[model samples]
Target: MEKARAEAGWLMPKTSGYAACAKLRRRGDYKEGTMDFFDECEIKQSIQRIDELLGSGIFDRKHIGNVLYRSAFIDLLICLRDLMFKCRKFSEPIRFTDDVVVTDEIKHVSDLVKYVRDAVCHPDSDAHYLEPGNIRASLNVLYGKGTLIQTGDFNSVSEHDDDVCFFIGRQRIYLQRHIVRAFNEAKDKLLPLVEAASQKAIAESIAGIIR
Candidate 1:
């Protein structure tokens, strides 16, 4: 139910893009009788949707991944993909403004996000879905090592003592910590960069249409 509520922003344009843009135009929120006005408006609207989807999630997790802590984990990946993915409106490579060095940690986190995103969106099989894999991933991120579960033994996140990850009490804590770290890094360092770039994309798109 909470996830459904959070997805409301992403669903908005699909629900009301045409009518809302028309309404905006009538109100002079966009320049009247302009060539790029509507296109630019749409680009800004897309960026706004991305912003709304980035609303707060659990970042204060004292330990690692939990039932409730998954919001930030999932949302951050979606947000990163939006920023880095190619878009005609923004021709430049998405990057940091202050030039914060992309260290191994950042790169690893990025890779993990993509990996997790793929698993979520396109799993090969039900057995290969987000179960033991998620547990293993959390262990890898937090403990520097992870053990894989035998499918015959454990397959679900709820699967307990039979899981390879079941015995790792230390990892349960680490998993949440890793999640909190990833969420914080994206929020503190990456959010502003993407936001500035998104604004620039909207402005440039508008400029192109008008010129």
Candidate 2:
């Protein structure tokens, strides 16, 4: 602590024992906001796994359930992606120019991600208001009709159980592929934005010191 203060040309203040040590460590390592880049990378990798599973064409209904549950991580990725964009614009002057408008696309994506997250996290119930059909609807919106088919009618349990499961698995794979593609595109765009922003901040700080 003394070394840090001295190097920065500030007076070192004494602190209490364990709490002070913990505080100093936290202060030294603190990030300004919730997003961690590494976690975002992990989410991207998970999205890739979803893609791989889709390509393998070997997953069953239970496997799809696991993927859907794991997709809660996508919400975190979306939050981090938005935060990174905001950080990029942090020092820029606010303006009302039409070109500078923020869109609801991210929010829409987040909402869908949230729906998937909820569906996976909680059991389907009358009170929770989750129907398998809702998941199918969300898949349709995210992936398009060609990739996702919504069937309102299924034959009796013993008659078409295998067919229903097979169809559901196929649709789940399609949904997974679409999600992976979307997240990858978002990541590709946002990473450069974050790097540019960080570089600009560093340049400005250096210029300030030189001045």
Leading candidate by lDDT: 1
Model 2 lDDT tens row, 112-170: 33334444345452212214445333221221233234334521111222222112211
TM-score (all chains, Cα) for each model:
0.34, 0.36
Per-residue alpha-carbon lDDT of candidate 1 for residues 1-211, written as tens digits (9 for 90 to 100): 3223223221225656566446555666544333233443444444454455434433332434656445544554555444343231233333322211124523443344444444444435232332554532332222234444444454223223321111221112222333234444444444454456445546554555566
With candidate 1 superimposed using the best TM-score fit, by how many Å does residue 21's alpha carbon deviate from the native?
A: 4.7
Prediction 2 TM-score vs. true: 0.36
Instruction: Provide the lowest-lDDT 10-residue window in model 2.
Output: 92-101
All candidates: CA RMSD in angstroms? 12.3, 11.3
Candidate 2 lDDT (Cα, 0 to 1):
0.37
* Candidate 2 residue spans exceeding 4 A from truth: 1-110, 123-176
